[model samples]
Target: MTNYLIDNAGVLIGPVEFPVVPGLGVEIPSNAVRLTQPLEHAKPGHVWVMVDGLPEERVDYRGVVYRTDNGKSLLWREVAELPNTVTAKAWPGTHYYWTGDDWELDQSALAAEKKAQVLLERDTLMQHAQLRIAPLHYAEQLQLITQDEQTALLGWMRYCVELNRLEQSPEFPMNMEWPVPPTVGTP
Candidate 1:
């Protein structure tokens, strides 16, 4: 189990002191509050502590922090519509910080968004891989070659590594067949 504490600057608007216990996972409701700012300076791996007992509007409200081994990280981007799960995009090295209240994005919230673009790039890279030469083709298939592409790929690779180091996974097999040597084209 992971342990975390509520940030000192993250007190609620009212005078009530939020209770935080060690080894507890904070639950943020789907509708009440959204994380608005990037809690970049907060401690690493500390869970967001939620308040208990409120109206139904406040029921099921919670949030938490997630840190990856990579240097890049961000806050829990969640919505009340999803009920209990908060979605976050983290890179290779990062830690979590709990910002008071739930956060919502405006037109200017591109600073921490990565998932959609990354997914699209990965798809594009894979499509490009299908037409390239072997081995070199396979390496390209699994990687993003451009600088920006590489940054995005590294984020995804880090996430996968944290979940289940694919390099060591037995189910992940490598293709050793070389592509047929190109014959003289009669073009």
Candidate 2:
């Protein structure tokens, strides 16, 4: 059974999903506008300062003064083209490298860069945490245990077995064998 109405000529009819008529979406038009479809690159004649590397290493002499990454009041201005009194007062942390032009994205890429740095630091910390290993020994056979060494050798064997069983990966097994070299004992 047909759910949609059709004309006598047998063409399905429906309300238009997109009709063309627009005033403006915002109460006041903003200089900074987000594209409905983002552009691959900044518009022509636009001055864009791309900040990716360490700030200390980057040399930007454009009029745009950037906020230092250290989170202090010490703003970084171009030594050659320092901001005048009025421009310096208005310069914000949001400034990266500025094109003398006014239009820019409301948010910069700085936050994502900072987050990546934090994750790297956390990974370094985890690698420094030591995994404890209990003392152990290697023996050729059960008969090798002497009167005084019997108890010690038995304890070491049990420790190795329990450690391997607890930590071994079923899919990709590790060499859970003791890492140290065994020396010949004095009989």
Candidate 3:
């Protein structure tokens, strides 16, 4: 069994000895074998942002604005194009605006339309949430079921396990050993 050294405060801390070369500073214990496989990377554009608010909570025409990591307001325009007829409205003190074609409103009808739109938007969001949870359900099934479903379930389980291990120890080395220094005098 390989024993690895872990530095408490230095560059390499908490090192464990393993057959494989620890890619990063920390080492892996040789006895600790991988139990599961790694998860595959989600396809490009797989992730979607889910906002926590109602349509009324959303400013009309303005869509939504997000603060960028740079401390600037990444207005909706960054993710989508803006429409014409821009006007700002203050809601509960926070100003929101519409930058799109104005619609002539029959007050009551407009209210009903807004209500319907909110419901539709909520439904769509719920569907997206379901899709995101499906893979997790499959993984849970892998953990529970046996016999017939074992093989298929194991694949997903492995993927999840691998992904978690990778996250915990991203520095696990691919190669097992380092090259030895050549003897200077001996042939």
Provide the overall lDDT of each model, using Cα atoms, as 2-decimal numbers: 0.34, 0.33, 0.34
Model 2 spans with C-alpha error above 4 angstroms: 1-90, 94-108, 130-187
Displacement of residue 150 (Cα, Å) in model 3 is 20
Model 2: colliding residue pairs: none
Each candidate's root-mean-square deviation in Å? 23.0, 21.3, 36.6
lDDT of 1 by residue, 31-146 (tens): 33433332233234332334452212221123443332232334434323322223243222222322323333332234223434444544554444433324333455877355
Every model's TM-score? 0.16, 0.20, 0.21
Clashes of each: 20, 0, 8
| Per-residue alpha-carbon lDDT of candidate 3 for residues 109-149, written as tens digits (9 for 90 to 100) | 55455546544644554454444445556756677544434
Ranked by lDDT from best down, the candidates are 1, 3, 2
- Candidate 3 Cα outliers beyond 4 Å, as residue runs: 1-105, 144-187
Better of 1 and 2 by TM-score: 2
Query: Best candidate, TM-score-wise?
Result: 3
Alpha carbon deviation, residue 157, candidate 2 (Å): 24
